[model samples]
Target: MKEQLNSLVLKYQQTNDEKVFKEIYKLSVAKFHPTFNAIAKSLRASVDEVFALYEDVLLRCIPTYTGEGNFENYFMFSVKNKRANLYRDRKLRTQKEVLECCLPKDDDTSAATLEIISEETPEDTLVRKKRADQRQLIRSLLDQTDETTINIVEAFLSCERPTPTAIGKTLGIHHMTVIRKLEKLARNFDSKQFGDFRDYLIAN
Candidate 1:
């Protein structure tokens, strides 16, 4: 039964025999009409209209069968598409009514709307090249430092709203130790680098 249906579907897809295809489809409808009719009624569509709506979908539905999902699955899927289309069509009609009632008037309002809709500046992109350079320098300097100092420095900067006490608690060190570690980082990396790297890390 499944193999015959599969062959019939393949033939329907490939064969240009309108008479034969119609004949086979009618036979299948005779066998399948009860299921299809129930589904049509559920969609609030007349059976003829439902069949017309399903023409393309039914064509696609052929391949989906694969003898894997049965008639019940196909029936249920067709019904689901019908229900979804009905809901979508209703929503679109409502939207069309709203749009017809209030069409856009002029360029000034359109310009403001465009300004609101336009993507904001891509995040930090203008400074990105300089940021990359700073990050490379930071990474290089830290690569020369001992691992513990590097870890402490990373933990310190990771906090956006950082507090000295919070960082001290995280590193299991005294606030003074945290401060000293940061103060000495410039010396640890390069004895004479820039202005206080410590100030960059400490919240206080």
Candidate 2:
């Protein structure tokens, strides 16, 4: 596995060519596709539509192909959603005339099938929620630090405006105290999974 990943990284570095993706597809799809197709069909898509979407997914994943674990897993999430969207859109469009004839309503009474076709597993959704909560928690945590920490973080958030040196001076500390505290804030409060974005407060 390590060797294969190394080879892929080398290939990626050597050429940004699409053939590397084809090679990755050829190498990785032996046991992956059948299991993937089963998962998609289980999610309510028809077998034929699942396969068609699988082809499209392979093309999408091609650019990001790598000999890495769970690459296919992420792509499966994306492909399942794409398949669901395609099916829903096509179904709605095909029935447009019938729908118009049945009721002169602007919107159809029927609900979209996409509501049933969830691309994210319950675990994935929970993980995302937990991560978001963690980030919010981190922000709150930073707020509880000394006023200097809060001021520094707020300054970083202000993109156009200059950070007042007086915030540092008001703390009765050196100018570098702000920078050092920012690093400590990241260490103690920021998330490892998402990286400490105190470095990019202005980006918020």
C-alpha lDDT of all candidate models, in order: 0.53, 0.52
Q: List the residue pairs that clash in candidate 2.
A: 157-201
Worst 10 residues of 2 by lDDT: 96-105
Report the lDDT tens digits of candidate 2 across residue range 1-204: 535644653474457444564555455443455665675555555444444455445434544556465555656677768767866766664554332223234557664432223255565677566556554655776765887677666554532322323435455655446545654565565355655443234221
Number of clashes in model 1?
0
Model 2 — TM-score against the truth?
0.31
Query: Candidate 1's C-alpha lDDT?
Result: 0.53
Which parts of model 1 have CA positions greater than 4 angstroms off?
1-123, 126-131, 188-204
Model 2 CA deviation exceeding 4 Å by range: 1-23, 27-49, 64-70, 97-204
TM-score of 1: 0.33
Each model's total of backbone clashes: 0, 1
What's every prediction's RMSD, in angstroms?
27.8, 17.0
Residue-level lDDT of model 1, residues 1-204, one tens digit each, is 545555566665556345544544544443655675786666655555454344434433643555554544574588568668965765664454422233457755653222222333444364455445445556777876677667776775566434444667787876445544544565554425544443344322
Model 1 residue 40 lDDT?
A: 61
